[model samples]
Target chain A: MPPFLYIFLGALAVVSALGVIIQRNPIHSLLALIATLMTVAILFIGEDAVVVGFLQIIVYAGAIMVLFLFVIWLLNLQVETGPTGHLALKLFGSLAAALLVTELFFILAPPHLQVKFTHEPVGYGSLASLAGTLFTDYLVAFEVTSVLLLAAVVGSVALARRLPGTDDPRAARKIAS
Target chain B: MIPLTYMMSLSAIIFAIGVAGVIIRRNILVMFMSIELMLNAVNLAFIAIGSRLGSMDGQVIVFFVMTVAAAEAAVGLGIIISIFRNRETVHADDLTLMRW
Candidate 1:
């Protein structure tokens, strides 16, 4: 990628990410997040991570964002009102975040650590190579991920389910009807 | 090819924004989105480093990270929904049930 183009995309991503935080409405934040995810996917693809880039687009921008939208609408959440008095907390958080980014930059941006992008290894972006790495070496971790997903699904269902005669709003509505 | 340092810089900036969002935003849902943003920034860094070194490990790791993020979203949103059901609010400060 051209240096100018990389910078522009990076700037756009940052701006969109800022929108995720700055927007008062969760739906707008969701939209901004989609924009950021798309730009990141493009950046990944440009940087020779073709498979991961497409996965980011499909898994994140496609599936995860839709899930976010579904929950937002299901909850019927309202726009977040301004805090009554949390100026100090906000100031403290901003200061800490600035400090952290500065520290990360100092550690990562040093001239001695600057690694030029090198030649792409054979099959670096191929499915066969990725599957080889994931299945052969990280097979156990992959299995564990399945287990984790199962547990998460079970747990979320248990939490979200409304038992009859409980204080669940849905249950109350059903009773009223 | 862009230097990995710039990628790292971009990741750092985005991650910082995420941190700020999680801390400054009172809405539980927005804080959750901020966490996802931070995870995505880290994924960018991983892919950037892998590309710089001509390795595929970074992509694999990002895949796993995305999986974990999916699970987290499922569970976290479930918790948030349950909390909303009980408390009738999603503001972080208003959640005192867990506070001492």
Candidate 2:
């Protein structure tokens, strides 16, 4: 809620995001991503979205990150070495990013475009209110997401399953032993 | 009260970093992480705007976004694992099986 807290957490999120981009090892990048997710959760809480903030932690930082780590270990990925693009491509990418940032700055800088924080009802971001709206108005969407998640689970399993007589060394070893 | 512009700007900056990551990183996993970063940046903007306007819709949308992100991560990692099984590499550039 405090201005200083926002500034501190925002800066930390930015730095961690940079770490995600710069780290050569995917494992290190995953760690940096965890930091970024945590900071974003804190920022969400600071903005009074308590449910979303905690959900960000439980889902994104906890479950999703563990999944990422599991995949990294499963594949046993090595250090990335370097990107495939040449120097010219890299320069062009940087230039494009810089231009995008500049454009965002100009769009966000107008004095008259600021959003006014009006008086909100008590318990605006409370769990009760969120649940009420979600169940009544967004129920269809909520149910659809559940179905989508189920589909994802099934699809992932199907894709990752090994076929019979595949040439995978690990599979062959399993059959041998 | 913190200015909404500051929060939005911060989100924009992070979004730019995410774009750069996607463009510059060759590892598919890291590129996926960058995409997550971009999603979070949008979530930040959504929450900020919702808070400023005294509405709850933005937070609700964020919940959906997080759900979609979770599903995407699952399916994507599964595909990556499949790719690794067949190709034994994770570099985006090395995935040329579909190319002519």
The best candidate by lDDT is: 2
Candidate 2 DockQ score? Answer: 0.72
* Separate DockQ for every predicted complex: 0.71, 0.72
Taking all chains together, each candidate's TM-score versus the true structure is 0.93, 0.93
lDDT of 1 by residue, B25-99 (tens): 888888899999999999999999998878788889999999999899889888988887877787888977676
lDDT of 1 at A171: 66
lDDT of 1 by residue, A1-177 (tens): 899989899999999999998898999999999899999999998888888899999988888888888889878977876652278878987998999998998889667576665677788878888899999889999999999999999999999987676776756777899
Candidate 1 docking classification: medium
Kindly list the per-residue Cα lDDT of model 2 for residues A1-177, writing each as its tens digit: 899898899999999999998898889999999999999999999888999999999999999989999999999977866555556766776787899999998888857456667755689888997888788889999999999999999999899877777778657677999
Q: What TM-score does the A-chain of candidate 1 achieve? A: 0.88
* Winning candidate number (TM-score): 1
